[model samples]
Structures are given as structure tokens and as C-alpha cells.
Target chain A: MTGQDFPEPGPFATLSGAEVDLGRLRLRLVAEAERESLLDVVYRTVDAPVGRLLLAATRRGLVRVAYEVEGHDTVLATLAERISPRILKAGGRLDTVAGQLDDYFSRARSGFEVDLDLRLASRFRLTVLEHLREIPYGSTASYAAVAALAGSPRAVRAVGTACATNPLPIVVPCHRVVRSDGGIGRYVGGDDAKRALLRLEGAI
Target chain B: MGREPFEVVVERYGPMVLRVCWAVVGPTLAEDAWSETFLAALRAYPQLAPDSNVEAWLVTIARNKAIDQLRAQSRRPAPTERLPESIRWEEPDAGLDLWDALRRLPRKQRETVAYHYLAGLPYPEVARLLGGNPASARRAGADGIASLRNMLAPSAREKGPR
Candidate 1:
């Protein structure tokens, strides 16, 4: 229940800075940041079951996605401070979505049929997510395709940025987006995880 | 009659206990099991038979806890995506390339290897911990070892006499 229960990024004493005393200051700052991050992870996992939790902040908004986790307190607190206090657990509303996810993992479900709260984003990102949603199950589109679908064919980089900043992956089907050169582009959650998602989707 | 000093237990065999837990259940649940295992061990220590191996006794307790956890997770059937990062420990470094190949193993075999090889328990001891007969534990350990060797030999040979 406490943050100490989770492993944080460990501390290390490095030889840095021109003055040896300054190195101590840097080490203190590093330790403090690491402690804060570890606390964040533990707080986030309090109600979450046992899976990936993503905290994303956009220029205009913030989105917290708790994948397979139990507690919603940490994420709620995060969003409340950054965005607004209108945070809801969406557990009951997400029950249906969970069912679809189960099916997807078992390869019995192909598409997601859920109404997401996308008001946390701007018009451009919202439009991009909508188009990304249509990329279909067991198939992938490129950043360029998503940009074209979002009504700006020249905005491939923008699409990539949006995907990188996406709060939800499987639900939004961001794994369905690929590189123009047949590579799985970088995902915020690490490329291996993205590859795993794609392989699970039978897209690669 | 009271709990042993946690720092004492953690200092003495934290890494060993963690290895056993991670071997059986992966790192995700290792921390909880680790804390619980020591707590249970402390409670049971007074009642422990004098001749019994303390490590085996502790490993058995951890095994039961880990298995119970997995079973509980199975009953829930929720989407794993939303799982909190706290419970998700990085995949264990089995210190060998073949560790990844062990991913496809049935739960029991995986636990057997973890108990026998990774945790460094003898076959009979592993059996006692898993609540199986000595023979079964030996077989499980043997089978698991053989499977890993079979899957890993090619890679080992590719490295050529290391």
C-alpha cells in the first residue's frame, strides 16, 4: 500500500562535476527525483491490478491510462493536479472494455467497441485518435496514413507525435500504426512492448 | 513467539528468497511473497521441526503463497493492460539466454527449475516444498533441466567452449 513496497530506480554515486562537492549536490537531486518517481509508481499501483500504467501530459491536456491496474487514486491525483478534478475511475464503464480486451488477447475479438473520454485532448489529437481508431483489428497503418486520415496528409510527424503521446494504446489501437518502411516505430512504452502488442494482434 | 526482525531475515537471505519467488511467480509478485514468506516463517519458526531444513521450509511457504496468488489472478480474468506498475517487476535475469526460452513451460516445470536450479534446492527438498512426492520433484527437476539443456545447447554450442 505504501510507495516503499515498489522498487524505485536505485541510487548511484557518480563521479561528475568539476568540483567534487558539486557532485554531492547532483547526487542528492538524483536521489530525490528517484524517490519521487518511485513514489509515483507505488501510488499509481495501489488500486491497479498488475500491469502497465501510463501517465501522459500534452501541451494542452493530460491523460492517465491504467492498464490492468487496481487503484485509481494515484492516476486520479496526477490528472487532478495537471488537468481537472473531474477524474472518474471508469471501472464500471470500463467493464465492457475489459471484456473486449480479454477477447482480443484470446484472439476472439477483433475490434474495440468502447466510448472513450477524449475531451482531455485538443481538436487535432482528438481527430487523430478517431482516425487511428479506424485502422482496423489485426492490421496496422503508418503514421502517414493516420495523418492523411486526420485531414493533413503532410502531417506524418504530427501523427507520430500524437501516437507517442497517446494515453491509451490497445483501446485506441495505436499498435496498428507502423513505420512507412515496414518497421515498428518507437512507442512511448518501448518498442518491444509495441512489438508484443502487434504480435498479439497478429499484425506482424 | 513473535515476528523475527525483518531486517535480519532480509539481510540474511533476501536475494535467495527473492530468487525462489521470482522463479515460481516472476518478479511481479515476488515482493509480496517475500515479505509474507518471512512473516510466515517467523510465525512457524517456533514450531519448526529441529531437523528440517529452514530454507526448504521457507521455500515451501513462498511456493504456496505464489501459487495462491496466480490462482487468484486467474479467477479475476480482467484485462492485464491496466495492471499497476508496482506489481510488475522487470523480467528476471536468469543469467542465461535459455531463460527466455523457458517462457513456454507449464507453470509446474517453471517452478521446478526455479526451485531446483535457480533457487539451488535439492530435488527432494523441492518436492517437499511443492507438496509432491520426492520422485515427482526429482522428475520435474530432471525434466525441466533436460528441456532447458535441449533448448539451450545449440546456443551454448554456438558460443563454442566457454
Candidate 2:
């Protein structure tokens, strides 16, 4: 700011001129927080065909994976309210998941092995999701079929709601659910993204 | 009412708190003070008034942590008698070499100057930490700066080349 104006003369500005390595400090902060168990959530974004995917995790495991259209800031705010507010962008915390996602998008991987925290979804929806993943890679299961497998044979609409609100999208394989009428149906990440994922998996 | 993600608070005020901690406690302990300050702040962040002065709150935490660190260091046996020439870093090229000059003042003077000048806190808040009226906090800061100038200014011409 002083550079934009004439440089002001004083001991004040020059007094605190020590070079602090913020990058180093941030890394150290992450390590210390982990050691103390003070870190509630760590998040980072990965570039993908789906645009930047905001990946959030707690110490337990991967929590939320959001598309750009979902509003990363808004998603983080919800996490702050529902979980703890002590979230930080630790560049390394999500490295494994990010790499796994890169593999998923590039088709080098067919399934996710990383741990997941699905506490955000309700119980029945969660049941629908568990059955959704068993559909296998590069395959489709009708929403009604998923609901039947989830023990709610008549709750096809509930199955659709579960897929629509799946918190951990590609990792949990909710994109594999389709309409029994031989249509693509809707997706949490929009049908276009769903099509891209389906096409990537060679399912379409 | 909503709260910002804690990362935003750290980015906004972390460096400033570190600088103030450096002035109050010296470089060796500043990072630890900063770490403790932010961790503590994060713990209590949700309860903080949304309109509160976040910087001032952080500086207050830093001050308390700095004092704790200083007390901890004082309890250790003095190392000076063991090593007459203690290892030191390279000195600044000009002025009073601010790091050393600030430490030479009394604690109240040093902290008053640091909070007001380095952290840009109002005199009332500095007084809150130092336990005096705003006028007294202002005087202490002025006296500290004047003392530093007296020690540093005359030496600039004479000591610059040397």
C-alpha cells in the first residue's frame, strides 16, 4: 500500500519486517493439528472432467465430494454447521483421494478403495446407496432394482432421492443408478456429468 | 448468523499475529506462540461475536501465549555463562536492527509498542492488555519509540559505515 503512495518514513513499518515463511508455517500447523487431534476437517480441490471437485475429509475418512455446480463455499458452510468449524486446506491431506479421483476419471481405476464417511446421509438413503455401489463398475442397475435390494422394494422414489443426494458421488458409485424405462434419468451432478461418467465407464 | 471457514481467519491474521509475537517474545518463541494462538482461537471461534475485531482478539491470545513461553524459558538454567559467544543470526543492514531493540525495552513498553505499532491495535485495547488507561498505553509506546530512536538514530550516521 505504501508503494502506491509515497513511501512514508518511520520505524513502525520496518520494525516487523522479518521474513515469515507462511507456506512452511501452514504445513507445520497441519502437522501440529493432526498431532493434537484439533483438526476437524481438511479439504482440497482436484481438477477433473467434472470441473474442480471439492474433496472434504475428517480424520475418520473421506466425507464429502462436491461438484463445482454445488458451490464449494456453500458446501463447506454446511459442513461447518453440521460438523466442526475447524477446517483447513491442508494440501497433502486429500492427496490419496485426489489421485484416486484422477484414476477414476482417467479410467485407470474402476472402483474406489479409499475410506468414506457417509454419516451425512439418512439411514434408508444410506441403504439405497450401499446397494447402489454393488451394481459394479461399468454397469447399471435400475433405481427400482436398487430399492428392492435395499429392502424397500416399493420405494423406488426413495431410491432416486438417495442417489440424488449422494454425498460421496463417484467414489460411492451412485452414478450407476438409472431409470428402469431405459433412460439416463437425473443425477446429483446434472445429467450431462452423469453421461460423461457413464461414457467414461463404457456403460453408455 | 454464519461463521467463515477457519482457514480464512488464519490466512487473514496469521502473519500479523506472528509479527506481533516476534516483537513481544523474539523469533525463537514466536512460531510456537502463533501456533497456540490460532489453535486456541479455532477452538472458540464459533462463539465469538461475528462483528468482533478478529485481529485484536488474536493479538491478545498471542500476548498471553508469549508470556507463558517467556516464563517457561526463564525457568531453565541461564546458558549465557556456559557460552560467552552465543550463536547469533546475521544482523539487519540498517536502523536499530529492530529485533534486538524491541527486546531491550521493558515488557510493558515492548508489548504496548508491539500491539499498537506492529498489530495496529487501538490504544484502548493495548491498555486492556497492559492494565492502564489509553493515555498511559499511548505514553508507554511513545516512550519506547523515543528510547529506540535515541539509541538508533545517532548511531545511523556514525554506525552506518561501520
Per TM-score, the best of the predicted structures is 2
Q: What docking class should model 2 receive? A: acceptable
- Per-residue CA lDDT of model 1 for A10-108, tens digit only, reads 110010100112222223322433333311111112121224453332222223454433234444544544443222221323445556666776778
Chain A TM-score of each candidate structure, as shown: 0.62, 0.89
Task: For model 2 chain A, give the 10-residue run with minimal summed lDDT.
Answer: A1-10
Worst 10 residues of 1 chain A by lDDT: A10-19
Positional deviation of residue B67's Cα in model 1 after best superposition, in angstroms? 48
> How would the docking of model 1 be graded?
incorrect
Candidate 1 C-alpha lDDT tens digits along B1-162: 222322233345545666566556553555556656655554455456545665677777888888886777678864332211222223322222333445556767878777766555776666766778877876776677666566556566467443
Clashes of each: 20, 0
- lDDT score of model 2? 0.79
Q: Where in model 2 is the C-alpha error above 4 Å?
A: A1-9, A15-20, A91-93, B46-52, B77-96, B149-162
The C-alpha TM-scores of every prediction are 0.38, 0.84
lDDT for each residue of candidate 2 in B1-162, tens digit (9 for 90 to 100):
567788888888887887777778775677777888887887788788778888888888889899998898799863331100111223443323565566678889989878887787778888998898988987898888776675567566466542
